[model samples]
Target: MDTYHKFAAFADLDVERFKHFQEEREALSTLKAVEIDTDADTRLTALTADVKAFKTANDNDIKQLKQQINASTKTYQRLSPFYEQRIALLDQSEAVIVQDDDLYDEITRTKTTQLNADRLDDWRNRTMVLHHQLNKAHEQAKLKEEAERAREKALIRRRVALQQRRQQASLKRQRINETKAYRDRFDNLVVRVRNRVDTLDFKVIDAPIEVINAAEAVAAQAFIFTTLKHTDSFTTLQKSLRDTDAKKIATQVQKAATSLWQQLERLPDNQDKVEVLTKINERFDHVPAITIDGATLTQTVTEHLQKTKNAIQAHEQAQTRRYSSPRPF
Candidate 1:
């Protein structure tokens, strides 16, 4: 009985004050029409700031209502099982209620307010949520400070990168021009060298000595008929002439040197006393050409250049082997 009486007193909390506030709100609404003796200039201004602030707070409160609703929904779901129990319990408690006086009035008022509070809780939560959204909009509207800071940083980076790109482009242009000039000069030198080689000329002359010349013509005729089957013929030719080591040379080179020596050895001059001009012309040609190709190409240039380089290397290697004999022959 004491616990029931305490709950009744709690349920009526702020009832008198809440009533006073409600009555004042009604009076304020009717004041203009009733022509109350209120000063025109001294009229109250609208509470914009207070209303907005309160609305924001209310919206936040309402937005959080889903959790409470979910809880209540769960309770309502479970309420069925407990419904008969609750009704039975309330009946038993109502009998106990008749055993008190002041407790009855307080209990009735408490029940009335408690029911209303329970019903309006969801609405309050919704109001709080709307209030918070309004506050967020207000914050977003006042973004001048952040925008200014971002603009400053962005401009600084833009200028730095622009200057860097300009310098890089200028350096690239300079390098390209320098390379073109170097290539132009090299091309000019090659053209002059080619012109000189194209003008070079040579003529075949009778072997510089009479005896060597006559004997060479006869041996040349003999070589035309020779089948190259003579194994000792090669050895005999090497022994009869100025060549000390003919066997070590390439086949073509050995044949050419042997042919030249065979003609010279059969000359009418002293075979033992070797002459100077006869030895010098052996395995040698006087007129040499500048051997660089002068052809031009657009896209097919690389392959042509590779083939030309390979050919030049082979030609030089042949010259090295032909002239580099360890003997005077």
Candidate 2:
């Protein structure tokens, strides 16, 4: 520390010691919220204030300590030489200072002495109180920390719930897109089948090969769920929460549509594709499987995405039009 601060600390050691001398050592750190106030009052009024300050409690309480072992008396006696030093520094009063002979020889020792005595006590009392306040501050800080921990925990749980909701939303989106792709391919296959039956040259194409190599194109959309790692802490009164969105998806599904447009694409157009497909059509509820080899399901997926976006936007707009309520809390 700097010189002034060091001396100030030395002068204020009583209060510092009091804080450190608390019943609970741990509470000392908590109560550190108390501000350090080192400003002293003017000598005259200050002395009088110290004698009565405890009765008039404001931010800092009055320090009223029973004089123990006459320490002040002993201190004043030892420091009396300093008073003489001050007296020596003052030259005899000249005619310029005093016109009257009687007054010229006189010194206001009584008033000065009383002022000094009172002022001395004021300093002692203030120091005692400063230490007392530091202790109180530490206690208060501990309580504040407890409250903060509780708030932090609640906030973490809220964030986790929001994250889970987003993951669920993303999962649903992937499922819908894949389903749509299958439908689109099925539709295309249906169109080709009708055309081929009408033509005289009847022939079959390999299922997987036809789907991927078809004149029509299909897209692969990737997306999935994740579990995060170590980011949480607990305190005496509560705990801290932490989370990160920096992980990769752990799963995927491939959607391929064939040359025939299998709304269902379940059966590749191989040797037994006709019978297998016939049974599939008889077994399933939807024709997207039969009519289109997975309908160019691309358009369907794009539509679903657009619809979701539109619905979200519509909801936002609706929300904008409505008035919100105040929280009961």
Candidate number of the best lDDT: 1
- Model 2 agreement with the true structure over 1-329: per-residue lDDT tens digits: 24345446545764654454443334333433343234222433444554356235422321322232255567568668546543542343232223333332333233334435444444334444544665577778877887888889889888999898889888677556654554454355445544533331112332344532321222111111111122123221111111212121111122323332443244432334443333322322211221132433444333333444565577777777674655466
Model 2 residue 219 CA deviation in Å: 24
Q: For model 2, what is the C-alpha lDDT against the true structure?
A: 0.39
Error of 1 at 308 (Å): 26
Q: TM-score of the candidate numbered 2?
A: 0.25
lDDT of 2 at 74: 71
* Candidate 1 weakest ten by summed lDDT: 283-292
User: For model 1, what is the alpha-carbon lDDT of residue 205?
Assistant: 31
- Residues 148-199 of candidate 1: C-alpha lDDT, one tens digit per residue: 7788889988988898898888877765665565445435644653343233
